[model samples]
Target chain A: MNEPQFALRIRQHLNQGARVDARVAAQLRAAREQALARHRSEPEAGLALASNALGRLGGVRGLSLRVLLPLVILGVAFATAVAWQQTQRVAEVEELDAQLLSSDLPIDAYLDQGFAAWLKRRASQ
Target chain B: MAEAARLAIALAAALLLLAAPPAAAAPEKDRRWSELNAEQQEILVPLEGEWDRLEPAQRVKWIGVAKRYPKMTPVGQKRVQTRMKKWVKLTPEQRKQARENYRRISKVPPEKRGDLQRDWAEYQSLPPQERQRTAPKKKPVTAQ
Candidate 1:
């Protein structure tokens, strides 16, 4: 048969098939709706077949470390600041110690407040 | 190979988390006198007798001092060693006062410093009664 004749015959058969029993058509319509709903939902529903949202985040590590990272960073930053402050204080002390240790001024001469009073008196003289 | 790389990354992350706190906690961490490098040990030798007795923070400070030692003039180095010997014997109150004196003295002009130091020496040589007369009057001693 020629192509148009073949197409016309197929269309006629489809039209006749369309005139189905009401109950059967209703069943077919319900099935088609169900299939359409599933197809529309395929992408989202596919994930459920694998695992939940939490599990897909590479399991426990992702969950724990994501939560753990910010907390640990905060703790470390605070601790490091404290350590750096203490280090700065120590450096100040060290510089002072090096200075005082190497200076020509005697410790007794340095420490005597009366000596300062006496020096002022001598200077005024 | 990919699995191994992932595991290594995860392990490294865990280790980084574990190590960070201890590294930050080093302010109070102690190092033995012997743990000091040769230069530190040699420069810090004067403190050896007191090393084990010193606080961790104090040891850290002394190590810092030692690190700067090589740059000092020979006389300055000798003076440091000599004064450090005496320095360790001072009470905390005396040390505090000495530091106060240093802060004030350092601000004096270089030329006047010698004169000031000489005056201090002369002032100290005065008889006790002479110094008493020269010194600003203190609050009268109360009967115990």
Candidate 2:
């Protein structure tokens, strides 16, 4: 089928919003097969180049793993150390809070309204 | 004579009490702003009203920088002054826009930034009249 005729038939089917006819389906299938066959037969230099490149990369993969594995491990260890330090700091803060609550010093007593009033009176005098 | 000596000793003790500095004043906690030098003051005045609005960590960060680089070069001082002046002139919305632009520029790769700077230097080297004539009429379209 001509390109224009094939496009017209596809458009007509789309406009009708119904399923395509068997003949149109067969034509489309044939076109797709033709394209695939051409693609398979073509001598693609890009593919050959890519295969050669991958072969080269395979040699470096071992070296890369040796270098990268330790780096990855170090990064994980550093992250864990930071998390542990943060947890320790939180624990220390809680301990301090507990100490503040239990202490004998009358810290809050000094902040009493009566004491403030007395200080204000003294300042005025 | 003994009475006079006793009186002198009492006066000496009183003067000693008066002259002694208070222990409570040793830890003189005051605004860190007052300790800034003239050049630092110029750089920091832009952040004046916004000083207390800053987080404790941010305040500490700036303070550390100020302490680390106590004195700046003449060109650096001038640049800081210009930036501060520009900062003060900007509206809140304009400031926000400037900050977003800065963040976007910073996110670009260092090599790209260097390239852009080199291009800008070349552009600036052109004669003023030529530069004005060649300048784009409209702002460059930026992708969202």
Best by TM-score: 1
lDDT of 1 by residue, B1-144 (tens): 643654565566566567655654344346798788787778878888888888676677777777678888898898888777677777878888888767766665555434755767777788888877644456744569
For all candidates, the clash counts are 0, 0
Residue-wise lDDT of candidate 2 within B85-143, one digit each (tens)? 34434465654444433333334455433353343455457577755553334764356
Candidate 1 docking category? Answer: acceptable
Worst 10 residues of 2 chain B by lDDT: B21-30
lDDT of 1 by residue, A1-125 (tens): 99999999999999999999999999999999999998978864654544445455656433444344455556765665566667667767788989777777767777776775555444445
Candidate that would win on lDDT = 1
User: How do the residues A1-125 of candidate 2 rate in per-residue lDDT, one tens digit apiece?
Assistant: 99999999999988887467999989989999999988975754564555566558776433434344345555655554465555454444333322222222122222222322222322345
Predicted chain A of candidate 2: TM-score: 0.37
Clashing pairs in 1: none
At residue A60, give the lDDT of candidate 2: 47
